[model samples]
Target: MEEADSCRRAALEAVADVEPPRLHEYLDSILDRASMVPAVLTLESAAAMRTEGRVLEDADEPHRDGESEPDRNRTQAVSSDRDPARITTHAAGVQLIYEGLRLTRSLAHDEPWTATDAEASDADLGILAADILVARGFYLLARTDAADKAVRTVQSFGRDQTRREDLESGAETSAGTAVGIDGGDPASTDANLERDVLELAVRTGAVAVGETPSPRLHAVVAEFAADVGTSFPPVADCLTDLHARARELSLEDSTTDRATSATDP
Candidate 1:
């Protein structure tokens, strides 16, 4: 969908200014492998459905009397000004933050380094890209309602990773696929990263529409994300599933609101 395309473009554009062509290319490649589906679509659909019937103009720029038509049109197509594409920036922020965390996890797991100068350079640039992505993501959500959730997600990631390293360092046997979120196993820690990030997506999306996700909604997202079993999908299927469930829950919530409103004096 439109939300995926829009959010991906926004993410790529956000990193367009990274110095050195090779580093920029590396960052682009990382993003290319990312499924810009879950977080962005959740945010877009929530905001769109919640604010139905209202026009949300692209707010990236104030219209100028003398601005060129093409410029205005281009801005509107990618900017988070309206529904379907509403909250593109916020969605992009959640996506980038997740990607950055994912990258950091990879670096921690692999420690990719070599004797060759070029390989070492690439490794260094990878770290740089991760930092830039997280920083940029933070900048986007710095003023949004999801800011604290985003921060907590990152903090949780750090804690999980740290615990995983400590556990691995002392463990006598490989935990394998049997590991779980409570077992202090490496795989489960990794799953927790995805779980927390996905939860952030759901919460961020809901709050973007002025609604807090109910506890049941959080439980649903967490369970789905944790059960992905290690590697995350590089397509929209997983996120699509989440969006469908979230939408259903949101509809239930909306119905309750309407019923309560109708009964109020």
Candidate 2:
């Protein structure tokens, strides 16, 4: 346990500085952990390849496209330029998170699978590894988006001569201040953005996609629509109604299943 804690700390420190001596210590400790041996080795190998400036063919290559040479070359260059250490870290972090989730799920189901059991299941390990890779990909994309947003926000703020008092007073503000270039109409634009994001997320290999509407979300949306003087019902209401129907359908399915089982020999 102490070794594991030390490894975690070292790993955290290694993220910022690849040359950190603690990195080897962390990797070694991870190697010591019987259950996490495979994951640890995978991470260590990736890190070593990174240190040696060796590119992973599978990771560095993007899907081919019948595009212009400049565009294709640029895409390949960008993929190659991505830091392997960062990729390894992201992958390891995602694997750790998923393993924790798996353990929790097993406990919740009262079919507690031990570390040994986890080690035995090659299929389960592969599935977890794939999930980790996909999760890391999503995280990298999100991080890039956040960095881009931050840069744009800073540039906009620097250019704008808007005052805090003016914003508070609802005074006429620059379009840049009121609606950011990236910010589009919430009703149509947000829906489209959500769809695009969901599609991209799935394409990047998200294992599950779900949206849960809060109970009071309907009221909030309705109030907003009323304030806008729009005749359309709130999106939250539609989601909530769909959820209710789904629950009803699930109950009916359960009843049917029970009846069928009862009638069976």
Candidate 3:
């Protein structure tokens, strides 16, 4: 938990320089829980990569010897580098916020899976709130020059969902069967959803910065995304350690720690 807080604070410090001030309040509202592990993890990973060539040295740090500026001046930023990793980190966080809010509204109603229930007056406020979140997500993506990747991600999700619906329309639902265990399998599991969103955000950030990520970076995002999607499952008892492992992976060239990975259902 403490590590997560440190990451959150560090990410906030970096993001504040590029994004609008008021937008941060919205991020705070969305990431107001321990369950937002995905955004936190993604933010930490990208922030580490973003600082690879540069120094953190945010405005809040104390001045060196022979400096004359007052403490008030310390609140200023250091550089205006539009780092790709940092940009995608912010975009991913926005996407997670949108998904979390939308999922909450959709699952809050009596018929949790019913599409119509979430649009009713009872859930109007939540639905509207989710709408704003998605808008904010698009805004951030475009601001970072990841508009194309963001568009592709959304289009992919739509196609996947439509295909799933089409499959279900012609499939049979017998006793004791889940949605994807039967003939409707489209590899749409909970973990994949988390991985897809995480990869999309990370890749979007990387793409915006005109970076061609190595296979290790892609693996890192997938592994971390699984952790976020499963709510830090297998190693939930040792989240601080898990975070440490993830940080080490982000800052160096290292293989994944499969021990912390979530189990398949």
Candidate 4:
């Protein structure tokens, strides 16, 4: 859980320096939901464990004699200071990206700006905060193997949002009344966001541990996401099960490869 806490702190620190006190406050408010278990971080941690054949709790082991402060606080490293492959860094990247998308979803669905001039300004700040959070996420991932996947995740979000917008417009234009965002199915859009981001988390985590996630691995991750469906602070037992399943799947793939190679000769 230290890794998850570190990820949450890193994400907040990433956006801490935004100008305008109100904007910083707004950003903090937006990230308030991060108090949950951080599903993306959990997935990434699980995948990393699967790839390394190690345990997540190992990070929590007591330090050896004379361990420096930096060693104790490595989990809290800033975006530029940490290794790109560190699971905490990668997890924070996906976390920021998801939070940004989540804020955007709220703006689109709630339309909070239409309330008044002050609310309009607040909405603008919210948009700015979302941009900052996503940019920070990309900054964290810019040098990692998962960079391309991270880019695609954001692109996918844009495409989904655009599709939802077009659908909303069609509904309003035809029905002569607001049919609600995505025809009163906001949960589906949010689920799509969570599913894609969680997949990215798994891929990035596996990459961090020096393995490219196979299709079978991706399939298992997808199944896990589908079964969980946007539940935050994922259950510990479920995460442990996912970790075991991923390792099993990886082992099966390795066995299949060995068998195929044996017959080829």
Please list all clashing residue pairs in model 3, or write none if there are none: none
The number of clashing residue pairs in model 3 is 0
Top TM-score hit: 1
* Alpha-carbon RMSD to native, per candidate: 7.5, 21.2, 11.3, 8.6
> What is the per-residue lDDT of model 1 for residues 27-133, given as tens digits with 9 covering 90 to 100?
89988778875556456445524633334455564798888989787556534433344477778888899889888888878777754787667778888999999
Query: Candidate 2 — which residues are off by over 4 angstroms?
Result: 1-35, 44-82, 111-265
The lDDT of model 4 is 0.67
As a TM-score, model 3 comes out at: 0.54
* Candidate 4: tens digits of C-alpha lDDT, residues 105-180: 8787789877998888878888888898889888977877778988998888887777666555675356565544
Candidate 3 local lDDT, 87-183, one digit each (tens): 4346444454436434443444233335565446435444444555555566555544456655665565555455555555544344334555324
lDDT of each: 0.72, 0.34, 0.48, 0.67
TM-score of each: 0.78, 0.23, 0.54, 0.71
Worst 10 residues of 2 by lDDT: 201-210
lDDT of 3 at 13: 41
Clashes of 4: 0
Give one clash count per candidate, in the order shown. 2, 0, 0, 0
lDDT of 2: 0.34
| lDDT comparison, 3 vs 4, better candidate | 4
Model 3 spans with C-alpha error above 4 angstroms: 1-34, 50-78, 81-119, 171-191, 204-212, 226-242, 250-265
If ranked by lDDT, best first, what sequence of candidates would result? 1, 4, 3, 2
